[model samples]
Target chain A: MSHTRYRVMEAGEARRFPPEAMARIEKILTRYPTKQAALLPVLWVAQETWGWISKEAGEEVARVLDLPPSHVDGVLTFYTMYNLRPVGKHLLQVCTSISCHLNGAESLLERCGKRLGIGLEETTADGKFTLVEVECIAGCDRAPSMMVNDQYFEPMDAGKLDALLDRLSREA
Target chain B: MEKVLTARIGKKDSRSIDTYLADGGYTGVKRVLTSGMTPEQVIEEVKKANVRGRGGAGFSAGVKWGFLPKDTKGKPIYLFCNADESEPGTFKDRLLMENDPHQLIEGMILASYAIRCRNAYIYIRGEFYDGARILERAIGEAYAKGYLGEKILGSRFSLDITVHRGAGAYICGEETGLIESIEGKRGQPRIKPPFPAVSGAFAAPTIVNNVETLCCVKHVIDRGAEWFLKIGRNEKNAGPKLFCISGHVNRPGVYEAAMGLPLKDLIFGAEYAQGMKGGKKIKAVIPGGASAPMLTAAEIDDCPLDFDGVAAKGSMLGSAAIVVINEDACIVDVAKNLSKFFSHESCGQCTPCREGTPWLYKVLTRIEAGQGRMEDIDLLARICNQMANGMTICVFADAAIAPPLSSVTKFRAEYEHHVTQKRCLVGARAAELVTV
Candidate 1:
């Protein structure tokens, strides 16, 4: 609302550390001996503020942590957890690793794709969901594991998936 | 033999400090700090307990802690809990931390004390957002209760614990790669010679330990080393071990038992996996995470699920993440899937690993699609052999070869069938081999 107090209105371009986020960054800095070491956590805070790390978001992170943009890009691309582009409201990651593959992962992913009317790494037109295949989320104990944003849904099948997707769609 | 690491798992309010303390959680760390047991004594007990790492490598935890320099010349020692549990079939650490966060906290405190670490961090993978929140809450509780921070329990021992989440690089599980990630750099591993123990995390002497291994330190202190030696199949591989049984198991989950539980027993035992799904016939097993070579059904018959036991049969007990394959699965399909995983996860640090992983996956894909030549089978082994054993800065190249090489060796006939017959051999889509 007040453009005078903020550098820019965007999450990444204007790398605005909300007072709470700034406090978190300060506390994280105390955890490490150097400020640069707080880059990962600070970047995480940025990602949490924004849905994904855009080019401007990456540059803002570099500027905040005193790291070069190239370094931020390199670090951002290396880790799969950090999203490079905007994601839909819900991001579903299905595991197709050895354990999950043995279980019906391929078919499970196909079900999600067909039901959502989107292929792998695609977001629905309504901007409600994005489906992608991830390596492993350490839920091998319950094979055919899928992650809905941050929550783990295990032993996923077509029936459970349909019900779950119906519920997500029904939500405002 | 009783549950050590998983004792608090499945209990009511398990993640809370109140429940943890009521169940005697931090008593191990309290006993070590208050009982006048020197840091050296704690390290000695861990060494005697013979606790091997649970994160794939199975190296001795005590021996790893002992590698810290006797004199750091004023640099504060650091302790990193490797929570990057990305190994394909491993998920025990996630269960441990999610259910019993204090168990890991207590274990890290004891381990930090043993190594004179002033600052400790849990480098958890970012995918484990649930676990990170649980641990952050647990650590706050510990600090409020004086189990962590300055003058812990008024015993003159001071330490701080932080949870650093990895963005999502599998290589970060490698100790050096983890160190680099923590330093706000790419997850590419640092060259060895001056290992993490000598200089790591802010260029200070650091000790990186697996989550389960740190959790084991609490028990080694609680019950004493001799008591630990009595539980397992043998003294060399002792203490409670968590084996992650995935795939076609009827009751697939994390089963903790005395070390050296026979491989077949874990698969067919009443208490473990309770046999394969639909009583399907076993074909092959990945004895340890994706890194360890798979074992044929015959080779796994008398196999023991310990470091030395699994090794005796040709595969290392790398994380004890047992993934079973029944008669319905295709071996070529399995190898190709694993190769694709390796190709996707390669850190691109080494020439051979960066180039060779996708090459291996491409060849496997060709074979699985009924497009492989007979010579491609031998070529697979040749490509695998060149990528590992000092071919890279880290052992990642070595691990990327496990699936391809082992399958080619044990399931040669299956590979031959795929090439000669131009299709899979076992799955529903498989065509019968024609001898013309």
Candidate 2:
């Protein structure tokens, strides 16, 4: 894993959420047929406010949705879209699932690890980047792929990853 | 040295099964057939190997199969391979079918044998015409070789596998919805607890596995269970997993690694991703897929690249395709775009999902277009709340609500700015130009 010591903000550093945020969450709960229906969105709000969904956040969502925290957590854990922790400035989501692997994604990821000076689950010293091995990213024609900051790049190689890192570092 | 599974793609003799056979194809199946591994033994081996589903869910394949009733009660056990790559930012399965269809066939056969399933189907997406065609032809080839029809590989067990093309609906990618579609019904999900394993296709005991999940059977059989278990870095979700990266990276494609590789390593490692586009800094990321929660740039260090890690972070290792966002991007616009997609794709069977989706889109769209009022933002949140938690069946409804709710909460300033200032505070005029 990356550095164990992530910069935790003091409780005072936590930004005060606009009152409307709570009102909005409440309104969303009413729109659902059942309060539990609002669980995902409630959790989403928690994640957005906290930057990641914590156990407390899950409980908050569960309470709003009239469900248990375990229930909310079960749903959160099943899907790929929820984030449980803080992410880096750059998220290196490498696709090694079947299609991408058949196209040489493993070597590409290995190459990325060597060049970037980080392994999966670890962030760069500057906290600028985090490399996560993903399932698939919907781009197979261009194999050996990775996604950086919501943009899709394909047919990646070690060299390409290196250049990208330099560019990200410089930009940061 | 190239791995055996990926050797056929972009190389000489990739499209033909004969070439695949020449290159050690079907050897795993033959081994399974000759080794006298019974269904129980096969299941045991798979469990021992610690293989999980490669599809977005990451469920244990052996455990899922174990859910089936022991011995058929004069009813055929059906197996359906979900080839619907409907999840946004997930396309690895399409390439596997396009390049090497036989590997899938052999793997499917092996899985069927292991589960004692006599009938199976591959429900492919309609958009993947080429993949469907290739896999259909491969099934034919398998039949010609006596590998798919009665008496597969001269074994007593007979199996029939067919490929069914699907109309373009994201919901069909869901397991029950896929089952419904295979049965020629609208692809709407069914309630659980008569899980497909217990009562599936034709109300018979059935097992549904993703294309990649079945394809992995060969790997498990070739290597012993112990060897397979040791492959993944994540002790729990053992063995290698594939990650398809797309987005504003230098090199975005697919890469395979042991489970639990750190997200940091995945990004910087070889063939992971080449930073952001146009030298822009990463602003946020959707680590799993489009449906996954967004990770702000500051929170990237919460967990490793495993199910537990993502779960702890309040997201999942869902079809772990990281959708990265750059500093130039507007979070509001992303919510709008995703909302529009889900709204457009909802089957309209459930009122909450059907109406809530479009309403959410309208609110997000309005907010993104600088046409939102303070109440509109609240409306978006309320609508999100209404549509979540299996409101519409499957996760699509909840998925529809996640982005907008999260966006409004995390980027309230942006939404408030839109309403208060009547313009995007990010100075993002280009973001508003999107139709959604």
Candidate 3:
């Protein structure tokens, strides 16, 4: 509920994992003894191919791994990292866990909301960034940590996030 | 204390295998293979080393390996290295993995040989994408160096190490839950009787060790057991321990000291955290991770940062994640935040934890938001009791109760203030925080 909203079932099925991902999946299969056990990685490949895990995407993963669609749904909904629908290109995950909270993560979050013109779990008007409060990332040592998509930034404040947002916006 | 685990951490190119070998890494497993050190002999050496699991449970590593059946009925044994360190206020494992991954790899190789496991996996947290990449590179390096794969170091012993990343689920930190997640299911914990050692990871005998525990194993093999024994306060708590200090400490980071390092020394020691930030006075300290009970400032005067030492103070050093709270923090708000974490992470299996966690969160949410009644405080306590003990398959419910239960008991006046006055006790500093 705090992430990608539920949209109506799409008319047609999504495409299968791309050729590159299929190659990656082939290697991932060797690591696991069973096909079903590679479900998480295969689903991750699907998400990487398409920005999100659509119902069709789930079916494709199920078909690939020889699992039922319901099992794929169960796995998808249980983990928070997967995208049920499309998310912004840049996911601004700010930490609001106790350690970050003590280091003024709440104020940083509020600053992000004010600057982005969006509340929690909301993407900006241009859809460049989606801001969400995350749990304690292992960077608690730095406190008030945030991840700009994949890279971890430490001891973030309003100024740093604002500058980063400005730069990210200018690029695209 | 000798810094076996962290010795190569800050060195140049620490994560590379070249640096690792320069510092004599992978020698432990090489010695084990070339010298014909039997699996039983390796286990005996570890037992004599007296190194406890750096994971929360603090079980002796040797005793746990000894639990495997003598005759496995030909079922292939497996080893799972737990790198899913999502425990709030805990990040020590991330350090070892990111900075000097070869140390962990060598440790896993040694552990796999000791347990006669041919295959092993590192179940790292998905949020740690960067850490995972670093480990993947490190594993590749290890394989290229002939330290892993079949006929490792020219001996009959062979091993394969794979790094498996988990999607975001805190429950996966639980060993059984980890087993289930690696099996490609929702991270729900299994009921224990067979245990992971008996039936785990595709119905094979398995041993799940923490990142730090395995790292210690490599050192315990390199250094004799007697040298390992002399590192800590006692035989029960021996080895170099990585303490993750966060929150209001001036120099919050991972510090590796001998086991049983004094609590006050970590927070105020000149070589450690130094002191509280901005000259703030200490209010409460969570000695372990969020799952451990909170201790008042006065109670931590003589606290020792070890499994038993903290347990003696009615708190367990569950991962040695020290979260220091300054006087400006609202106790009710702290409890509310942690309760929300447990609520979000509950796998929703047991009726008690599934329902009780959200109930506790709701009441605390109301209380922290200035809508609580006087009865809500006691209701929080009653709800915690229902979710713990044998009521659930895993200790998650028990852990879910620690934050709220400990806060309400230790800081009842703060809760009372929030309820009656309809505001946080630290209202003066509320302007500095936006209260997300």
Candidate 4:
């Protein structure tokens, strides 16, 4: 497996929340009594706005929440969801935990790798899909599950997974 | 016993405010607010019902609420509903949040009133994007209906609930770790003595409860405590419980059964998992989530599926997640998979857990790959002993050790065969089929 570290967005890169994101951020801020308590929600807003959370995005969140840049970086690196580098249009997070593994998640992942001609954590040549093996997404009842973007697809075998990939490719 | 907790799940428009209100929802909170009952009375009622936390700990919910200092003159009390359901085999919380959002909301309001808190937050796991959106919409509907916000239900009580999403960390399921994550830090469990009730969430008196536990609070109020106590086997393990059955089962899904149901029934009963898939003989069972020790097929025959029952059998009813393993799968492989999970998810705040978990994974991987020495077996046990109990700040380290140690003890011959033969015997057949 490739061990690529999270890339840092260079200085002078333009990164600011648009008007709609600002409105959402304001609404989220009202939920918490303190500005710092909204840090995770605000970081989510940043990630939603910029696909992945870059260094510049982290700094912007820090500025908005009045937190230190190092603190933002620490929190960002701790969680697995915040992507620090740009990803494909569709992020396929396959659950490789025990239950999924028992139900053929490894073979399903291998099939994805074979079909896409890319290994786990690699993006497709066309930038349509990025496959990453993740921990349990809590869909054990329907094992060998994966999440494309934010939606869940489960009980997937090689044929069904291939069909899903073909459909996504055509849609994209 | 009736399905009090998950009764509304799978119903049409179950998440909407109108559907919730039409079904006599919000009555629990309304009764609490409108009646002349004090916070202590609410706590006493809950205590009488014996509602235990659905989260792994299974502590008494009412007793935990009573931990708050009576006089927090200037300090604000906070109530956090832990929606961070990331335990490997646990998925019951997501169903309640996604389907019966108002049930949880009503529970939260009653819990807040019992603790006399004005602010509450639901720290949901990051993977549950759909559940979070549904809960957000439900909260909005609640606010619009005046079930929440200022002077709720024309009573002096008021509460504002917020939905905070965690960014993929299993440690956040721990109450203290959850508090730290909501505070915008690494999700690490804090050392106790200041306990959350003493000082939590912005250093205020806080009471953190699981999503299902809070939902049970709604029922404990709607139906009297005596009624709730009469549903399950006994007062100690009262009320309907949600059991998440997965792995090797014919119908692997969430089943709501009375507490203290037999483990064999949950696995083989038609209403539960409908027996193992393909008529395969059961080899072992992980009674709880990956954290609890595995029970050999023989040991699980008549075991009770409750906190005390499972504990009596040398395991926990943690999250009530039962993962059945058939004879086809390798025990060594199961141990290795769980080791990898714990090692990856460890917050690395403690020395034994950070160093011990990865070491356990490395040794297990080596053993699974046919490179293990005989001494590695005793070494593995030694490491587990060191990491278990109160050796660390939290139980994460202890949980990490359960799979490997338990598997080796219960299935020592399997580990020995892998080492001596330099190949996985049980997995060899599957590998051969794959090659063909």
Q: Is the docking of candidate 1 incorrect, acceptable, medium or high quality?
A: acceptable
Residue pair clashes in candidate 3 = none
lDDT of 4 by residue, B1-436 (tens): 6678888888899999999999999877777788788889999999999899999999999999989998987999999999999889889999899999999999999999999999999999999999999999999999999998999988888889988999888999999999999888888999997999999889899999999999999999999899888877678998889999999999999999899999999999988899989989777799899999998877887798988999989999999999999888988899999999999999988999999998999999999999999988888999999987999999999899999999888777778777888877563343232210
Residues A1-172, model 3: lDDT tens digits: 1233443477666666778888999999998889998998888888888888888988999988999999988889889888776778898899999899888899999998888899977878787888888888888988799998779999887788789888988877
What would the per-residue lDDT of candidate 1 be over residues B255-288, giving only the tens digit for each residue? Answer: 9999999999999999889998998877789999
- For model 2, how does the per-residue alpha-carbon lDDT over A69-122 read when each residue is reduced to its tens digit? 677665555334455566778878887643355446778888777777899867
Residue B413, model 4: lDDT of 75
Interface root mean square deviation for model 3, in Å?
1.7
What TM-score would you give candidate 2 relative to the actual structure? 0.70
Show where candidate 3 strays beyond 4 Å: A1-8, B427-436
Error of 3 at B380 (Å): 1.1
Better of 3 and 4 by DockQ: 3
Q: Give the DockQ ranking, best first.
A: 3, 4, 1, 2
C-alpha local distance difference test of each model: 0.87, 0.71, 0.88, 0.89
Lowest summed-lDDT stretch of 10 residues in model 3 chain A?
A1-10
True contacts kept of 4: 0.75
Which stretches of model 1 miss by more than 4 angstroms? A1-15, B427-436
Fraction of native Cα contacts reproduced by each candidate: 0.82, 0.10, 0.80, 0.75
Candidate No. with top lDDT: 4
Give the Cα error of residue B207 in candidate 1, in Å.
Answer: 0.2
User: In model 4, which regions exceed 4 Å deviation?
Assistant: A1-5, A8-12, B427-436
CA shift at B190, candidate 4, in angstroms? Answer: 0.5
